[model samples]
Target: MRALALLWGCLALRASAALTCPKEMSGFEGDTVTLRCTYESELRTHPKYWCREVGVFISRCSSKIFSGENSQDVMEGRVSIRDSPGELALVVSLRGLTLKDSGKYWCGAQRLGPDEACPVSLTVVPATAPEATAPEATAPDAAAASPPAGSSRPTTQPDSSSSAVGDPGPASSSHSSMPSVSIPTTRLLAPILVLLALLLAAGLIALSTHMLWGWRQALWAEDAQRGEKVHLPAAARREEEAPAQAPEAEETSAPCRSEEEEEEEEEEPDPAKFIAV
Candidate 1:
């Protein structure tokens, strides 16, 4: 019976400990809201502190009103923390909060004894005002202003009467009006004829250049043929002159070879003369 009672007590305590801070809470720009956190009997020894976490940095705001000794900056003068006569309350009065103040706030409870800290989340939803522009206010009024909501008077404008007479009818047969159109005539054909004559002269010049190039090419071909015919006679004369010079040059060279052969024969060592020496 004692063991069963202990088990039941543990289960009940676990169930009660599950109650934590609210997951999310939001308020208007000029309103006040409480980021709430409470403890079960198991965690009553630890005091709870509500803090704001912005980009891995945590700032402590309120604490200890829920249970044990805790600290907060609000305990000074930046904010006010109050516990009513009966309610376990954390009232945070924010003044004119903007979107910059919106962030993840943490309600962390640190145990008095050696125990791990537990934390819950609080999301601040800062209110926003409808955007306005000076241009929007100064724009032309599309619709006229309405009367007071309860008034029964109609808003329609009064009908306007015509003041101008009708247009004068077509002119009588006594007078006739003729509209005249003046056409500008240019002496353009004379300039165009002059430009065509200049173009014809340019074409004649280009044709003369082509004929001159052909005549130059024909003269070059004739000169080339005459040079080829003269080359044969010139080469024949050079060949005849070369044969006449060749006889004299070879006659001069023949004695050198003969003298070399004679010197070689005379330089042969004689066996009998060598033995006498």
Candidate 2:
């Protein structure tokens, strides 16, 4: 009887000493979650690993085990672990967690055997369910909050209409009849802009013509120097040959000559002063 009692106590101790884990952890699908298990400080150097719980029993780590040297670590496809060389802890990381990953799991240090494992329970929040709960409340709030614009319409618009009818109120009248009593802001500026554009175009055309005329003059001068006659355009030739009317030219130039020049021209030498010419 004494031996059986001692055996039962040891078995219970082993059962209770399985890997330690949280009561529950919540996660989202497609997110990473960590399941941390703390162990006896002396087990720090031992290999750490985790696996899915099977029938409430854990014998060894899963076939995909993560064990490395005391300072380094190991990883499997989606699961990884860290055995802190000094701390009494092992952090097991599950990457790309999915809805299917919610379940009971066990973690252990390799040297501690299956009976010394820790239990972890993971719960995933259904990512779709929150939208239904939150959006339902917000939709009514959004609709109710929309009539702010209509709130001022009753108090303000009638005053503007009264002013535009006969109240001699410039501000109110402008506000009420803006569409009908208006000139385009750009209307006056449009003709000025067109005139300026035309002036600029004419200036550019005159400059181009002047440059071409200068080039022709230079070529003609060069040809004349080389004893080659260069023909002028007909309009240019006619302009050079045409003279002002004689009477008009005399009238225009009469006052320009000095009195001394006219007097010298009128005093001709007498034939007797130049004897026997």
Candidate with top lDDT is 2
lDDT for position 173 in model 2:
33
- For candidate 2, what's the RMSD? 28.8
Best by TM-score: 2
lDDT of 1 by residue, 1-277 (tens): 9666444323322212323555544444444454444444554444444445321121233323232233332543233443221333333333444444444444444443332223333223333232222222211221122122222222221111111122212211111122211111123345667889999999999999999999999999999999999999999999899879978998999999999999999999889988997
Give per-residue lDDT, candidate 2, residue 176.
28
What is the Å distance of residue 146 in model 2 from its true position?
29
TM per candidate comes to 0.31, 0.38
Each candidate: how many clashes? 0, 4
- Where does the lowest 10-residue lDDT sum fall in candidate 2? 147-156
* Candidate 2 Cα misplacement greater than 4 A, ranges: 1-19, 56-61, 112-114, 129-277
Expressed as tens digits, the lDDT of each residue in 149-197 for candidate 2 is 2111111222334333665344323322323211222444577788999
Error of 2 at 130 (Å): 8.2
**Backbone-clash count (model 1):** 0
